[model samples]
Target: MVRVHPAPLQARLPAFSTRLLLRGVFVLELATASWGGPPVQVPIGPSAP
Candidate 1:
């Protein structure tokens, strides 16, 4: 059995938009964190897996 909570129609769009914005922010922060350390040097060779 599946049950769903009923939400007011007006709240749906705002909630979706807020979730999208938050996901974007999270991705940006993750990318910046990756860049915070010294860059890695990759030896020239066959493409790395």
Candidate 2:
């Protein structure tokens, strides 16, 4: 015999946050470019495979 489970119908928050973060980084880059300073590096997470 075999059983199957259904996935939960949850909000895709991780995907949403990823997109939001990327947009934020782009905006930050634009702001920093106008400042004429060295680029700041933010360590958000470890590198993935």
Candidate 3:
């Protein structure tokens, strides 16, 4: 039998995917707020008027 080792990047994939998902949600929320769907106060980014 042969043994195999996981690459460094494979170990970090889960966390990277989670972060990507969260960022996608944030972008969607920002787009909706800009479209006047609802008031989502994003105090850290550019204000869309």
Candidate 4:
């Protein structure tokens, strides 16, 4: 049997911050693409495989 332990809120904060950072970067890219001509190809996440 395998047991899984939930992470504490403090431990998850960094991930949340990283997500926010990614979102910000995506938005900036979107804005830049809008200003430019062609569409930008943004990956889903850091590791998209």
- The predicted structure with the larger TM-score, 2 or 3, is 3
User: Scored by CA lDDT, what does every candidate get?
Assistant: 0.78, 0.72, 0.83, 0.83
Q: Which scores greater on lDDT, model 2 or model 4?
A: 4
Off by over 4 Å in 2: 1-11, 37-49
Candidate 3 colliding pairs: none
The better candidate by lDDT, 1 or 4, is 4
| Per-residue C-alpha lDDT of model 2 across residues 13-47, encoded as one tens digit per residue | 66778899999999998898867666656556675
TM-score of candidate 4 to 2 decimals: 0.54
CA lDDT, candidate 3, residue 15: 94
Order by TM-score, highest first: 3, 4, 1, 2
Q: Pick the candidate with the highest TM-score.
A: 3
What are the per-residue Cα lDDT tens digits for candidate 1 across 1-49?
A: 8876666656697998999999999998777766875565565778765
Write the residue-wise lDDT of candidate 3 on 1-49 in tens digits: 9766677779889899999999999999888878868665667657554
Residue 29, candidate 4: Cα error in Å is 0.3
* Model 1 spans > 4 angstroms off: 1-9, 37-49
